[model samples]
Target: MMGNRALLMNFMEKFLETVRFGNNDFAVIAGYGDVVI
Candidate 1:
């Protein structure tokens, strides 16, 4: 579980970096049903 979270963080960082947003304001939300992370 820890490893998976770490991997997700790494991927998100790379993605956000590529976007190059100055403010870097974003949200990852669960939509519909019962979402679990």
Candidate 2:
């Protein structure tokens, strides 16, 4: 469980980085955020 949580955290970090730096579509990112949540 801990390992999975840590991996999730790492993935979230990178996902946020992509949201911050990536010039992708707002709808797509928002969709991903909704899915993640």
Candidate 3:
């Protein structure tokens, strides 16, 4: 049951919460790809 968009939104919400809690940092590295700064 859940739609793909709903699932994605849920995931994003969790990810943002994690970042907001200061568990990790968000960054984009060149060639190496995304890095959790």
Candidate 4:
């Protein structure tokens, strides 16, 4: 399992990429699912 900060950091990185690519659906689905982009 990951720590809180690590999880938050990971989410932040992915969030940025999501914004860059405009993949809002991916961002929402990725919250608890392990779907690779």
Give the worst 10-residue stretch by lDDT in candidate 2. 26-35
lDDT of 4 by residue, 1-37 (tens): 4676677778778777786898888877785463342
Task: Evaluate all candidate structures by whole-model CA lDDT and list the values in order.
Answer: 0.48, 0.66, 0.49, 0.70
Q: Write the per-residue lDDT of candidate 2 for residues 1-37, one digit (tens) a residue.
A: 9976886776677667667877457646754775566
Cα error, candidate 1, residue 31 (Å): 21
True-vs-predicted CA distance for residue 3, candidate 4, Å: 1.8
Q: Candidate 1 lDDT (Cα, whole model)?
A: 0.48
Name the better of 2 and 4 by lDDT: 4
Best by TM-score: 4
Candidate 1 lDDT, 13-33, residue by residue in tens: 655664575433332221111
Ranked by TM-score from best down, the candidates are 4, 2, 3, 1
Q: lDDT winner between 1 and 3, please give it.
A: 3
Off by over 4 Å in 3: 25-37
Worst 10 residues of 3 by lDDT: 27-36
**How much is 18 displaced in model 1, in angstroms?**
0.3
What TM-score number comes out for model 3?
0.54
Residue 21 CA error for candidate 4 (Å)? 0.3
Task: Say which prediction, candidate 1 or candidate 2, comes out ahead on TM-score.
Answer: 2
Cα deviation of 20, candidate 1, in Å: 0.7
